[model samples]
Target: MPRSWVDGLEARARASLPAPVHEYVAHGAGAGTSRDEAAAAWRDVRFLPHVLHDVTDVGLATEVLGTRLETPVGVAPTSLQRAVHPDGELAMARATAAAGGLMVVSSNAGSTFADIAATGVAWWLQVYLPSDRTLALPLLERAVAAGARAVVLTVDTPVVGSWEPAGDRVWDVVDPAFTRVNFDEGHDTQPGAEKALDLGPHDLDWLAERTGLPVVAKGVLRADDARRCVQAGAAAVWVSNHGGRQLDRAVAPARALPAIVRELADDDAEVYVDGGLGSGTDVLAALGLGADAAFLGRLPLWALVEGEHGVGRLQDRIRAELVEAMRLAGCRRVADARDVVGSPAPV
Candidate 1:
């Protein structure tokens, strides 16, 4: 039998990465366990299979911030795509849209937002808050004009951390050629940024009042913070840990999903998560744990590094894996997968 697309893509990513990036990729893939250990851990949690239910028409369709998606799978934002491929974010946007998945374009993307928006897909702009609104406003204007349906304010990384292996590598190998287009020099110490550059409720409200676009608060890990996001007029809460790059011992977003969901469940804000997701079963686990959708990072980067053909192939493999997991768990749709697991205990 042929190797699955994910397996092939993982191999490609391992082969193509600089040694430092390869180490980071390996850390995320293993999820703090060795490959064999992670697989063994996953095996210990078997799905309680249900039979005798009619599951002939499995629907994978879902929506995020009012945009209909063909599948619950989406491309999560990652910086510096050119390191992965020459086509960069352009190739990722087109391929993900072609596969009926959504794409979240990073503010730090190597390709311009205007270039990515031209693909005519359901794309969201992921922004890192600058100390000054002057630098942020122009980028926000450009994203809205370019047809971004939503703006995801990533509140993590107030100051870039010391443990970012990828950032260090990018600085050494890639940054001389690629500067952050959205930031001006000295923007980091502007007034009102003395504290960490978190986009608080006030910040969210200010942005919403200004842009009139659906605002989402990404990197929300606490329930109180999730509540504040909705109060600040956010359309959704994105729970993540920058794929474990920021804080080494932070609980995986999957473990934090249920509480975050429960806190904001009445606020009508969607909850999305990303971290340690590799297969369809992992996606299903996220939904079961209370996520509206699962954002895939690194995996798509792996595909991009593999080349143009790799994108569609990787998407297909993941979608198929999701469908199979849903079928086995007796779910005929993404919505059905939501109720597949009981409430999770605290991590």
Candidate 2:
């Protein structure tokens, strides 16, 4: 049998990475402890497959933030793509566009939004709110001018999380160099003040009043937070734990989805999730649990690290995995996934 694209890509990523990044990718407590636990716990919940359904015309198309996507799966905003590949966000954006998927550009992206948006794929901007609107407003404008379809305001990262070198082993691993060409780094404030930036509904309302693009509040974990985002005029709520790279004890997005969804059940806003999603089953699991869509993080980084060819290969493999999982679960479309999501487990 041919080696699966993901398998090959993972191998390539492992081989190409500098020691520090490789370790970060391998064992970083991305997002938090609960995120790691939830992902691990998900693996233990085996799918109870059903049979004899008309699996023909399995549709993966879905709409997010008014933009139509061929699949519900999207690449979440992750920093430093060039650390994975030279083509960086450009390659990932092209691959996503080719597959009719969405790509969220990180505020800290090694490549600017303009470079990623140039791929003609549907892209959203992810922002880490600065203490001053002076810094934040311009970035938002740059995203709009760059053709970003929406804005995802990350509200959880109040401070840069402590990043201990993975393991006791120390090695020479210089941080990869790349520029956020569109941003003014000199104007970027200190982390403490940046973290204190008001990210409440007032901020969302302020942003919405200023821009025509839709606003999505990312990093929501509680039901009240989801409700507040909707109340604030956000078009969507993104439940994430910053890939467990921020808070060590933050609740896993999956564990928090149901309550958040129920809380905002009356709201028109869409709900999305990201954290420890590794397969099609994970995608289905999220939708079942009330997420309108699921964002993938580390997986795409691994793909990018493997080089240009790895992008299409990785996307295709994930879609194929989703299709097969859907078929076995007696689901024929992305929306049908809601039927299979069981009750949320206790936190």
Candidate 3:
């Protein structure tokens, strides 16, 4: 009901969550420059509203990778949802299904892949391949067995990036051992998270060749990088700077769209984006710039604070806001979003 659903959600989260949990969800990588840049880039997009078009019957339904989604926004994989709420990833899946969108389950999920799939949420697994490829295959196989439709291979963190999570009250209570439950109970941290996979630029082709499921490369920000991924047989290229968690001075995923879109315009793989997108307007901006889908990373943390209900409410409100944006722009469909273009149209 508020003018900005995210503002109220953020306020509530700040008031309720401990300082450390809040910091983990809020702060970006070193100096927080890219985090700021990503949000600003969306503000730079301006829709070309057609005052004459009839938008009385606007539509948001769209399809991606041969699957239907009610809206183009998706839930991105975030680690340690257990640290935020009891339901965590399952709650996120339920909310996403309810919202008619997809959820990319994190490799560090507190729940197992089969368990998340059981919620009837069409989910893809976000995998961080360790230095050893052998350890990665079983995880992929397990995800497919559990009905994962795609594998969102997270390539930004070949090795974990450094960031000191804020506050100490969390560590004083929450076990450092409790974050990961998707793997062996004895494996306290994510198994393959720390080492490089020795992956060639074309190595993704090798991985995709072995799997029955589609392999989507996430964390790409350059058109050249995106082009290489397409050549590597990536089913999709997700434009992300790891939500600005890895690199400090990186470009925002939304700002990188024009170049990446141009490179992959003729390619089969769709371009997905994430980082600093917290509202439907932000989602609309990404769509207008040619992103097939936009993933909400930090916003979901606010939703997960109240479990699935919060997520559902946030999602419902976002779709509503998207419809409003379409109506004001005099756009009748998702495809119309592209009409906005990179530069403002002639006055």
Clashes of 3: 0
Which candidate leads the pack in lDDT? Answer: 3
- Candidate 2: minimum summed lDDT over ten consecutive residues — where? 167-176
Q: For model 1, what is the C-alpha lDDT against the true structure?
A: 0.74
lDDT of 1 by residue, 57-144 (tens): 7889988888889999898988767766777788898888798889998876777777787877789888876665656777788788
Off by over 4 Å in 1: 1-5, 20-46, 164-167, 175-198, 342-346
**How would you order the candidates by lDDT, starting with the best?**
3, 2, 1
Candidate 2's displacement at residue 334, Å, is 1.2
- Structural RMSD, model 2: 3.1
Instruction: Please provide TM-scores, in order, for all candidate models, with all chains considered together.
Output: 0.87, 0.89, 0.93
Between candidates 2 and 3, the lDDT winner: 3
- In model 1, where is the ten-residue run with the lowest total lDDT? 33-42
Worst 10 residues of 3 by lDDT: 338-347
